[model samples]
Target: MKRLTSILLSLLIVGSSVLGGCKNKNTSEGKTPESSAATSSVAAPTDKEADIVVIGGGGAGMTAALQASQNGAKNVVIVEKMPQTGGNTVYATGGLNASETSVQKKLNVKDSNQSFIDETIAGGKKLNNPELVKTMVEGSAAAVDWINQIGGDLSELGRSGGMSVDRLHRPKGGAAVGPMIVKTLNENIEKENIPVLLNTTAKEIVLNDKNAIAGVKVADASGEYTIKCKAVVLAAGGFGANSDMVVKYAPNLKGFGTTNHKGATGDGIILAEKANAALVDMEKIQTHPTVEPSTSVMYTEGVRGDGGILVNKEGKRFINELETRDVVSAAILEQPEAISFLIFDQAVREKLSAIEKYINLKIIEEAETPEELAKKIGVDPAAFAETMKAYSQAAASGVDKDFGRKEMKSKLDKPKYYAGKCAPAIHHTMGGVKINTVCEVLKADNAAIPGFFAAGEVTGGVHGGNRIGGNAMADIIVFGRIAANSACKYVEANGGYTEPSIVLEEAETPAVPEVKGNFKDGEYTGKGKGNNGDIEVKVTVKDSSIVSIQVTKHSETPGIYENAEKNVINSIIKKQALKVDTVAGATNSSKGIMEAVNNALNQK
Candidate 1:
């Protein structure tokens, strides 16, 4: 019977691989696969245990795991459903917001935590939880220092919407802060040898008879399993990407494009609900003012904070570009077809390095003259020219006449003008599972759920109704660390993490398949689909054996693709086969590269 079971499992594996291949082919042609076909090929563990289990491997989850480890938790594990760990943090272009930071002090920019709290409350329309916001603000400076100490670059300070000072810290070149922070966190996690289970979903948060967190029920490629633990941190992000959830909370937001990654589907919220945790502010969804409607790519608020202006189809400025996101988004929605254009000159582009990505994505329309750029974007050329002339005058005079804009940093006289068609898109969800100042998950009566903690976008009350541009980063780092610390304390008070009592039956390991065929003795080029777009590779065969594989072109995320490319290519060359296992967190890139190699070998 055991032998029969092994054979059946092997057949199932082969069947899944075939289905995955078909899915990849469809994905290459720009068709997203249904959820059923997106499972990974890696086998799930039958018996797993941890002292602390963190759901989601995005910014908050990773930070919680790392801090738990640092706080002396012996066994800490992170489970992420996505092929990569960044989550929506990968899409964040703004910087980290913190007041009275060393970065701000070094730059001679004055800011106060009280001021930060006040602005955050005003942005949230006074719906924020005062205690949670106060805790976040008080810890903001240390969070900035912590990120810097963890090898992240945040030396440059800039302003963002709803900020009273230059408290937003990013890289020196004004680059997108999300990728940089993700890269830093990933590098540190690797250095610490932390275990992050990719392609693993937390199906349920198991509790003990005492109503405390006892373990987590998780599912991966092989099967469902239980991870016994003393504590669980819910860092899985918001439901901005889940259209049903979004429309359920805010009915008016239906059919709106979202700037969130596909993984922000409120998994943690569901898990918390099952645990009987309180939910708060579920209807407070905020739409960003400048997202490319077709691609759902957000043009960072830093663009407008630097000098970019938003204009209607008639080429007239309607509102202050640096207004809070909710206000700006509402203004944009009132425009023709609910669309507006983000217009900027070459000088503004030079000051912000994040714009290079927009250029690379082919989303930004550029021309040497304002009239030419306007015509390309389907706007009136004369009106746009006059608008640019007036905006230049405002910049020269250090004043905005029409919109009362406060920060006019540059004149619009530089050549090579640019414009991108943008519209308001669902960006941030301010409501989630409720938590206290210490990051403890709360019951409806305001009592802490024993052994349960939450942080980042998974928790509500940090941002009342609307999230500030850079506050999300600060919220994740500060509260993620706090949640870990609280979980560690709880474990210690409960005599630390005890061994799991539940026993699970182990599944038979499948036998490895033999290499089927030899490759032609030459170089071949082939293409496959990656998480971002097409991935092309050049495969070199020598003596009818795979010798080398190189990724010639790809649009995958920077830090993520490198790991998949290196691991998959090296494994293919070493095994001399294409049936290698995909990288844990980078499944899509791994499969894409493997498919490209397989395509290369099949050439006539």
Candidate 2:
């Protein structure tokens, strides 16, 4: 059964959004976010105790905590800096990679560890951790089964992609993979009675008398507190949110913005460095080609799987859209100014749901003449026309001689041409604190930091330079479980370290049944979005937990409302002992709902 779940997880790990795991405003240097708490007077720290302290709340962190509990940790805690628990996972298109599995047998797709490995190395430029990647490839089938046991259904949709077979599986609803995995992991956490601390940021690692990892000093609403734990799992994601880091790591990419969430700073890497963990492949950054250049929000590579084409200002196809992300992105970079437009007719758009939502129906600018459209986007009219002519001829003949683009079945001939201006944006950071196959953080000299572990983008060396479309979620699940199992074993072997006093604070807000309406603040329009919106919410507490919520009005897209609604309801229930689920697509709407919930809770 466990094996079956892993296989299902691998195949179905496709539907989640990338959330721009690591991107920053400035890419001048791979610098950490300027510490907001630096100038402020440091608060005196207090020491609390736990058997395991997982430093993130994504799939990896939750998995580690659950495993720790199963391994006999009486007191385990997950410290998340965000108000929410699931990091980028909640935004992921849930898909996983498995080999030689029952799904493959059922689907009649032949697969093996070698073929998977070859594909990964080929797809990623041989930059992946050979051993760790090996483990992932070999153990993927089993991992999928385990995920299914955790609440995901194995029998789902099968999509075709860069794999040798239909090894990619997706869950029903075809929504965000992050929330689904998170929901399942959270369930296991509750069933085991684990403690999760939200809106908590770890400041520094607490080293004991022996200079080994002792605990983590964190800042929360109650001020600074030290969590003394024997084991610490660093699952704080990547540095994509840190603009400085992006610039420094990807020097070629100037003014490179990101679509990652704001919370995805390289906190784990900094904390691990403070603890002397080795950082590897610090230079290898993954630049996903098709991210919305302005918003930095991802549009998933499944676009190509849905039959999109890459064309220049001339309306000519440039590279093979079906090639690996890195190759395709690099090919696109060769354009005159490191920019090109992704062109597609309305006919192809009808086939891909994600592409339609992201790129819309237009393929390029309409200017009565191709030359006029070229001038609009600043392309040389003659050059653009010639390029387009060449491309149309090649595309019509069914051969992409220029860049070997095999998936040229779709033509760019349409009355209304639309083009998405694309540039290479720093997307995923494939490097960070090094970890073993089981996700234990390895030291500079090559050994496990007994009580320290890392997962997700925080611990690098997984993919050497680039990551496959749906592979990251698989990485999280694989390593998350590893961290959890390891932590649990550590706790079972040695009981919890020590427990310190938790100074509970007074409640400033009261509770309500539910808040009505939405936060309709007409500030920003969807015409040309520039920045991500941030909202502050206060929840009313009764006895130490939230009771209910209320909201005003806010403007956001409706597609995200589906999942956001349920997430708000579930959030209310879990802390309130109610049964609520996360909405499917409406993230901002859900957030607004949470804010309303918090606001209603404040009525003392």
Query: CA lDDT, every prediction?
Result: 0.79, 0.61
lDDT for 109 (candidate 1): 89
lDDT leader: 1
- Number of colliding residue pairs in each model: 1, 87
RMSD of each: 7.1, 10.7
Q: What is residue 150's positional error in candidate 2, in angstroms?
A: 1.9
lDDT of 2 by residue, 267-320 (tens): 889999889799998777777787656655565554455445566655566776
Question: Where does candidate 2 stray beyond 4 Å?
Answer: 1-46, 70-74, 153-162, 187-191, 343-352, 355-419, 496-510, 513-604
lDDT of 1 by residue, 194-313 (tens): 556656789999989988999999876557788888889999999999999999999999999898888889989999998999999999999999999887879988888888898999
Candidate 1 deviant stretches above 4 angstroms: 1-46, 497-518, 522-538, 552-555, 559-604
